[model samples]
Target: MTGERRRLRFRRFATRLERALDGGGAVRRRRRPGVCAALDRCGLSAYYVPAEYGGELTDYTELHQALRMVARRDPGVALAHGRTFHAVAPVWVSDDAVAAHRVGRLVVGGTRIASSLAVPGMGPEPHTGVSAYPVVGGYRVDGEEWVGDDLAPGSYVSLLSRTSPVATPRAHSLLLLRPDSLPGRGGPSGSRRLAFCDTRVGADALVGGEGRGAEIVLKARQLGWAAGSALPLGAAEHALRERLAGSRPPQTRRFAEAYADLLLCEALSLVAVRSVHLLPGELSVTSAVVGLLVPELTGAAALAEDAHLCREVLAAQFRSLVRGHRSPHDHRPQLDRLFGAAEAVVPFAPERIGLFSRHGSAVLGTLPLSVRRLRHLARAAPEFGVAAGHAERLLEVTDTLHQRLPGPAVTGDPGLGRGYALCFAGAVCAGLWLGGGPAVGDGPDGLWRDGLWLEACLTRVLAHLGVRPPSGADGALFDRLATVMIRQYEDGRPFSLLPFPMAEGEPR
Candidate 1:
């Protein structure tokens, strides 16, 4: 389905989900029992399956849109459903029939899934306390596993554990285990540990072969990077709606900045999802960039706090979506240490940057050609105006970073990574806005006004990178865009690439 149709479908569900939350923003713990029924009733559970498994895996773009919409109302619901997709992504990629069937059955049956992976940076000890030993028939597992608090009973949980005694870094494997398969009781626990023991499973329980845990988990992580990032993007969009609803002038500029940032993120996220879909193996760096930068830019926690949403609930949802996932933020030292040991690598190529692929260059030789063509088009197109300038400057900065990035001793500084993310986002916004021509919205000079928004984002990125631009920049552009955004929000339209109608219920 097209993204527009997907948004419409999600809008219908959003109404139901909005009613389900009843303005609290998440299903209460004591009310967890009926949550799956609510989700199943809305047909949200089908998204958990891939098309091959007889579920709605139309495309990443649609799934991303749906998740973002669901997140706007209840972030926890989106996190749970999205994380289940992460758990089963490896199964789909592995093409293991048994595992695929198992996952399909669960989704069709409206069962939730949980993921349990050893936390990165945890010392040699497995934080999950889950260990699988080879046994007759299959493997036996005995340890307490970590699971989401809202996971319903009889849910299928994916667990990663060490399968080899003489362990190297990659000795772990993935197992699809059930609470009933294990001889212990499993349910929501105050301690957050699902205690299991002497769980003997048949060989069919293994999703991926022995010692494939790292690969399987990495696949899941890559799939999750964009989906996980969308959670915060959705939250920020909702917060912008709430903040702009007040129609306060003093905060208009800030809201405009936030709206611009959110739009840029939407573009970057679209690029990231495309990257994962096309070049799955080479996305390690791209996924890290997205995972680290989306939440940082969206400021979901800060947005929640600012919107007066429940802090504790937001924190818990973030922990489930963001903290449990690995990104450049978690492995900065690892990258620094590894790159420090390697010999000097290849210099930066413009095509090597993610933006080049976003433009649809079919071959390496077409990259520079594509860039030249875009520049020529921008020059000829008066509508591009300032946004084209932002894109050009972005190429220069990306070139500088790429040239220096391949060398040894490059510090994996997260702030610098965030700066690069902003740079990329600015480039994407500029390119997309120019290519999309004038936006259909409230402003008289919508395209020109949006060009200023692009400039503002580039200004923030350049400042973060310590690159000074021509001075005398004013907030006038920001104020104008903010006015447009506030009007858009108050008019019952969403602040997004596609303006879908907001929930008809009264704002919190």
Candidate 2:
């Protein structure tokens, strides 16, 4: 299908899903089933499966967009439904044909697979609660695992179990088992707990291999961190909308700062998601930056309501950032494609994703060039002067940050990590603005025009990094962004960089 046609179909599907969700009401208890059914009716499950495995998941960005759309309305529901995609990540990365096909068949048949892989912030280590001892036929499993919150009798659970007695990275193994095959009971927060009391399965249950679980799960979590960046973005977008509503609104500066933060989040997430395909090896740093910043920014807006989720997400990013290796690599072409919103991305290739980045973040490292390009544009158009100035400030702070950054083994400073993430976000905004090509006659409307949004975002990033702008300068940028935001709100559009039209009849 043509890109336009596919986008149209997705928009239609999004509209239908929104209508279904709107009919479900605000009660969380009643909303879960409705959300799942709505998503199923819209054929979202198919996107969770790989194209080679009889599904339409040709690109990670497509799945990210779908998840973001769902999350805009309900983050919890989005996370719940996103588990299916998360569950299949290890299967895809492992490249085990049998496991892939089996999981694919289940997913294609609309079965929700629950994964027990340690959450992102929980480190790449397998859950210590579960262990599988080698038995005659298959491993004898014994332990407790927290599966999906709303799993049913026939649902499948992907368990990460310790396979070796020794404490080693390769000691864990992944298994796909049915809930009915094991004894499970109710757990907290509506989750199902699998109590495997010497349960045995055939060798076919082992995913990837006996000692490859850690590698598979690590890669899968990286994918999760990159893709799940959308969740917080959507939630922040919702918060901005709420802030704009009602007779009395917050101060314009506050609302505008919130909007700028959301734009920054989107910029980072856009690059991170596309990196999964274009620059997978470098994704370690990029995804970690995204994972750290999204929640931090969104949590400040009170959008990331789930504190536990934020903690896990932050913890994961912290570990990845501290362990990531930094080597310079040429990724200019990839960066161009990543920033170009209309560009078609390459297919998802999980094999390219590495546990540690051999090359550091191309986005952050390329900041100087992006700023130089912005300055050059300013020289020609004059309208880009303000944005160029902000970009230069961002460059100064980034250079300072580089000097303070420790080597891969030593740095665990949260402040330095946050500084790096902010710089990365600033770089993305500059790259995206420049990627749009030289602005002609003051640029297009909304955020793009006059580089207004870019300047605001840069200013916000600088402030986060402790570089306060000149007096009155910050307020002016905030006022401009707030005006644009109010316009979007009045026009029934989402408060995003793209500002796509919200589903018709969507509830406030």
Candidate 3:
């Protein structure tokens, strides 16, 4: 399909999905069959398959937007259905054409696949309790596995199994097998316990070469971390909207601060997703930052409303960061393509994805240049002065962070990690605003006009870093943000940088 037509297709699907869940009570209590049927009918699985395998996925940005659209209404449904994409990610990353074609065709044909791969913000270790012993024709699979909540009798299960007795990264391997092929009984919470008493299968079931499971799974998890950030972001948007709708809405300060947090989350998510295609090698750090910060910001939003659930969520974000971080290598990213919303992304190549970033973080490393550009823009357009000032503050914060950050030999400092994440977020906002992505509009009332959104975003970042601005300055910035948010709500637009058209009709 043409680019315009493809975008239209996604928009239509989003509208259809919204209509499908109308009046469906609480999302967690809703029937899975009905939701799955709606998702399948809308061809959600097609986006999980690569284009070379007769699927429609070309850009991670489109998929990210679609997931966020789904998540805005119901995060539970988004996770339930989006797991299909998560299950297939490893196959794509393995770069095994045969396995890719097979899984891709099955996914395209409306087949659901369940996997044991942990979701983003969850730890990266797969359930390795299952063991696969090598045999004459193939491996003799044995042991119980904990699959996802959506597994079915005839559907396929992708698992990471121990191939050797030694406990090492290279001792495990991935296998894609049919549930029916193994002798197992259904377990509680939609998991399966495989009692594979000498069950045998052809060697073709292995996803990649033996002992390569850790590498492939790591890369796949990086992709998941970047894409999965949309879930909380959408939920946060839902919370902000609900707050605005109440009879006695929150003060302008509360609304604006929450809205700014959501925007910063989106900025980080957008850059991380695009890096999967443009800077796959640098994804290790980029994805970790997203996995860490999105939840913290969302949790803070929840905390403002006295929701205690965010405490657990914040813990998960920190755990995910500790598990995912590694020493950085160096490689420059395609800044033009990375920040330009209209630019076409190159096709995804799994081989290009590295286990760890060759360079630390392209987004954070380029902060100096971004600050310089913002200063130049400030000179050219006096209205940009606020954004430039914030950019300069960000540069100062990041430079100090770099000097104080512990050497590679010592890692896992919570304060240092959070500081780095906030700095990266600041850089993303600066780069995106400077690049004039689609999120930045030229209309008289646009959020980017006079760098209003950027100034608010940077101010929020600085506050998070304990670098407080003038006492009342934040209130004024937040008040302005609240006004823009109300305007978007009245016009029935999503609270996003991109102006996606919401489902037509009265606001929900």
Global lDDT scores for all candidate models: 0.56, 0.72, 0.72
Where is model 2 more than 4 Å wrong at Cα? 24-30, 117-127, 183-191, 247-250, 300-334, 407-409, 437-445, 499-505
lDDT of 3 by residue, 450-483 (tens): 7888888898898899988776755766777888
Per-residue alpha-carbon lDDT of model 1 for 1-508, expressed as tens digits? 6556755675676576556555345454524446546766666667667656777655565567667766765565666566677767667655477788778878767776777745422123233477788998998777776764345567777888777876565567888877644655543344346665676777887886887675556555556775566788878877777666556454765677777777667766765665454444334444555676677678775322112111111221222222212222332211211111111112112122231112211111112332464467567876444545555666677555544433444343334445545554555455444433344342223523435545566655555567755654546656766766766566655556544344654333
Better of 2 and 3 by TM-score: 2
lDDT for position 103 in model 2: 86
> How close to the true structure is residue 491 of candidate 2, measured as C-alpha lDDT?
71
Tell me the TM-score of model 2: 0.88
Order candidates by TM-score, high to low: 2, 3, 1
TM-score, each model? 0.75, 0.88, 0.87
| Tens-digit per-residue lDDT, 239-308, candidate 2 | 6777677437657887778888888888778878888888888776677777678888876434233334
**Residue 241 displacement (Å), model 3:** 1.6
What range of 10 consecutive residues in model 3 has the weakest lDDT sum? 303-312
Model 1: lDDT of residue 159: 81
Angstrom error at residue 338, model 1: 32
